[model samples]
Target: MRGRFGVHGGQYVPETLMSELGQLAEAYEHYRGDPGFTTELDSLLAEYAGRPSRLWFAANLTADLGGAKVYLKREDLNHTGSHKINNVLGQCLLAKRLGKTRVIAETGAGQHGVATATAAALLGLECEIFMGLEDTERQALNVYRMELLGATVHPVTSGTQTLKDAVNETMREWTRRVADTHYVLGSVMGPHPFPTMVRDFQSVIGREARAQILEAEGELPAAVLACVGGGSNAIGIFHPFLADEGVALIGCEAAGRGIDTYETAATIATGSLGVFHGMKSYFCQDDHGQIAPVYSISAGLDYPGIGPEHAYLHDTGRATYVPVTDAEAVDAFEYLARTEGVIAAIESAHAIAHARKLVPTLDAADSVIICLSGRGDKDVAAIARYRGHTVKED
Candidate 1:
């Protein structure tokens, strides 16, 4: 019950993993409050991962929209070029404290894998990354980046050969060797402690954004928006704002083609309640209860399920989840580049696409904060292909 977010999260893992989970939970509880651990993690965040990422006012975009003032929480500027580094550093440090010699993780677009590899290298831990074969092909640059940081990349070909399959393979690997290894789950989607833990690590985004927005505007923004794959970035920025009744939490889910088509990965829009990947959450599943294949132009947003905490937030009306089609996201991706001279990740463009829609409805005096979750360098080639441009790689 401690892990359950209104019955959406639990230890749905195998019995063999129960004890390891217990040990991890205990260690995390102790280290989370331990001053030494906190100091080291804070140092890593500030000096290594570049914490306190800038919150920039998008004046050009705001004027173009002719509605609410727009602000971008620039997590894209962090080291390794994504918000994934926040959770990765924390988990890898915890693994070190637990005396684990190795760390393994599952990644989709490979941001998490790259970040995990980075942390493992910094902390002197052996690292392995399980990624979908489809994603490996889509994000080959990131695979090379991970390898450069000393991580072995395993491409999973099971299931739909996507994020879900990567998670499955990583979990299987963990079960086979739990004694000297730690599973650095990439998102807030796993069993107990993980969703809560990852949220805590990533909440730095919301905390800093809240302070910066108030200092700049003298008030909270009308809404905070972030793209939701497994919902780490959304929950990170949404958690601190949960108590502010005036602030709205919005999660933009990937609607690959459209929610009407089977190719969509908009879990909140098209999925039903189900248990998968060690958590009970909203998943894209067929009528027979089998997980359905999901698609998104952004490899990062290709997951078929929303995190349990997000499901809770949706059920309680504390947050609103909406679908952004690939066409719309790509448009936003390019629009941001032209308008703001900022190349946002395709994953983050989903949120930008939603913000383009929502900001138009709000008063000019109102403001909205969009979490620019990652830099777009890794996606430029794929995005070019999506736009019918032939990209020749060296």
Candidate 2:
């Protein structure tokens, strides 16, 4: 399997897990390029996960912004309300192909957890999800959703109670059950096969969007943007456009309060190169090189380390990664809801926020497409609280 995205991705897991990883890598490499596997995945994507998500022209938003034409690659409309289902379906199917009986994953905001649960249910595989205790509390709706899908949810209470901790716990669980279990890693981070596998699964976004945009606008857009949360959705949408030098690949990172403050998840904006989570990548860490506590208004972005591909992209300056503050993301979330009747996940809003800033600087003929990664229904309560409102539940 292709690893080391320009010196960033590699299998750095514990020695005990190397064999498991090697087996997975071999299976993935074979299945990924096989026509039978491709046919099955394509059919499942169309019938179950809703393939070919829309490329909607956000007319009102573009007009309001008073600059470039704006289009939204609507992954938000996918089944399970996020682009996460794409990878989950592929991984679960691979697990079945590998004769694995169970699948497990770690989630931060619960999108991945919900998607994993949905895939496992559809595939008739036992599923377990590890979510940080803090995430479980913040995303209780998703926790219940997972249980409803017949997956067990384990709340991890260690290490800032966030995405990183959930990953640590999931790796531990995988180590214990390697023979019968496949860990459905949620992002383009982690070891070699996972980053490559997840990215290939997600590349459908960019592939479709590229052709759709060209058909609609008669040319490639000036830029394609997506919010980075362990960089799955971003990588999914970015990988296809990598060779098109005319199209800029932009990733928006969460600046919880601001990059100036310690409470931020702007990994590329302020992180240093380090190793964690079985990959060599940039991470938000302290002077002593310990992973630092990270914060983001969007739970999905609250992780210390980013996907290794993102690290490589940053290093090569092939992609531009910038910080989008919580205030900006929140404002964009509300703005899209009011102006375009679109309620986007706070994580997705980070990209929209950056788009707001970027679009105004471009000509009207220029176009920008943002990967709307998920619906905001999951973040409604949190948004209300952020705006100092309370929703009374019946």
Candidate 3:
């Protein structure tokens, strides 16, 4: 448990980064419980970022799917339109406490970048974001939003020109600017302290959901589901329920086209254990250990590797990981929007896709909670184009 989840989590970074990583670990430990720090973070979370997002019972959608009742942990309603705010606020505050004047991060779908930029602006920290050129195009609105918040966006052209490449570019920038900049890693992956630190920040999701659900239903849910890109939201909601033996923890990964095809990002489904992105975790790698190119309709879930804690959970059989195809996710997205007026992020729709499958199999008395991680306004254009329509963004 010391900076690791079983044998999977460890710092696999360059020697140059080791010292900074050690210092970061110490600083995070120190400020994590300081009253002044917690007080400020709590105020921001409540007054600015909007904590305690509603646990909405999706009655119409649940009835339409024809199974157990469903509850949605509406992280999509949070500030910046996702649960990414929860961790960004914490890390940006940590950066301020460390006396850093600048903050940098890697982003894919732009939620993390926007959240980071918003935090930096609020804290008066200079911000820079690294994103793949492809993602910049796909998520153009987010890129513009970051710039509006006064953050520079670097569109990376390396590797597959995607999330993994963005991570590489951000790490390179961090090494050169380590003295004046703090890398606000966006997920529950990366090195030792990051996975643990991010999980702790995100654990608020699970804590809130557990209390809300228990109060509403007067019983524990049968299952809790969340989509897993690097598994931050899943870990956040899963952590509080780990001790409840009857409750199942489920993570849904993106199966871009199909799991059998190379054009998929179903790491737990087809990945092998290897080191990538600063941790020894499961990654989409070839026989000789070369990282594989990954794909998904949801930019946020297209990464080749999963977080080490997810790898540990997979190995120990303490949680279940499943693949949800892009087609299925699109169907769920449309279904939720139509049935419940909730336009879910494509990344979150992956979990909804699987929930549609699982709910039918369970008894009507059972219930499942899905983490609706972000709003879908950013994806409106892409979805409209995919569905053969012309829509204008205002």
Candidate 4:
């Protein structure tokens, strides 16, 4: 598994960053086996992230929807109120061990930026976050949160003023200032060790989902559902279930308004194979293979492409990708708030909305588990704007 599926993950950064990545790879490889590494992470998960986050069986929602069994992997309740901490903490700690004094990150919705900043604060490392100028404006609260955690926020105005552009800016910064800094990519979407390492860090979700489901049901669930922006949460919960023959992995893409809409960001459904951000993978592109701008109510899900590993998984037929529209995701967001006392991030709501559609078609006894990737605190205003109303509550 070297690149693409296994052929596309080589270190593609500038020459200045090559040694840093090499050292990082070596450190991560060593930590991959060290008991102390596992124990440290476990302790953090227990004390910081609240490990073994409840996999609550949604009796009300399931019964209300007409008897289909649904379970929620409650990642929204974690510290920082999202699954982002799982990977960020691991990477930040690894960065500290690598003797990096500065941690730099690029963010779209700002959750990952806030999470990284939080870890940096707790560990006493200098933190700097680069955010898309538009995203910083749209997700101002998260921008404030990052600043509160002592991260200096740099607004990037180049290249669509969005996530991809933020990535470009962050990479340029890393390339120029390779030493004493570590780039904490937010998802399992980057090159080489990032795809494998971030998945390893976030895999705790699936590791718990598997046992929780089997112990509660006495059998594997029929399907696993998660949203795919950069495809981190999907990869987290989908990896452990990949080899399971009976468990179907369904990843939902953000379909802004509709898959056919000019505003959609349904990468797997409408995108073609192309190169983006140092990887040869699926991308939403024009006839000339130039990248297309993407839009979604959830800023985090507005990227025009997905992770390379996801491209591999899709091609191998290990999982299926479905599109969930912004309207449907908002509906799901409200439904969760009304029915389950949960306000899901629009990114996660996409999966929840897709689950809403899938459950109606499945048999009553068929089970589906949805990864509630994050809370919606960051998106309340946007959701309200989309609904043409004031946000009612936090």
lDDT (0 to 1) per candidate: 0.95, 0.94, 0.94, 0.89
- The digit string of per-residue lDDT tens for model 2 on 242-300 reads 99998999999999999999999999988998889999999999999999999999999
- Tens digit of lDDT per residue, candidate 3, span 92-210? 99999899999999999999999999999999999999999999999999999999999999999999999999999999998888998999999999987999999999998999999
Report, for all candidates in order, the number of backbone clashes: 0, 0, 0, 7
Sort the candidates on TM-score, descending order.
Answer: 1, 2, 3, 4
lDDT ranking, best first: 1, 2, 3, 4
What C-alpha lDDT, on a 0 to 100 scale, does residue 347 get in candidate 1? Answer: 95
For candidate 1, write residues 1-394 as lDDT tens digits. Answer: 6799997999899998999999999999999999999999999999999889999999999999989999999999999999999999999999989999999999999999999999999999999999999899988988999999999999999888988999999999999999999999999998888999999999999999999999999999999999999999999999999999899999999999999999999999999999999999999999999999999998889999999999999999999999999999999999999999999999999999999999999999999999999999998998888888998989
The TM-score values for the models, in the order shown, are 0.99, 0.99, 0.98, 0.97
Give the lDDT of residue 19 in candidate 3: 93
Q: Is candidate 1 or candidate 4 better by lDDT?
A: 1
- CA displacement after TM-score superposition, residue 347 of candidate 4 (Å): 0.5
Cα TM-score of candidate 2? 0.99
User: Lowest-lDDT window of 10 residues in candidate 2?
Assistant: 1-10
Minimum summed lDDT over a 10-residue window in model 3 is located at: 1-10
Clashing pairs in 3: none
- Segments of candidate 3 deviating more than 4 angstroms: none
Alpha carbon lDDT at 263, candidate 2 = 96
Candidate 2 or 4, higher lDDT?
2
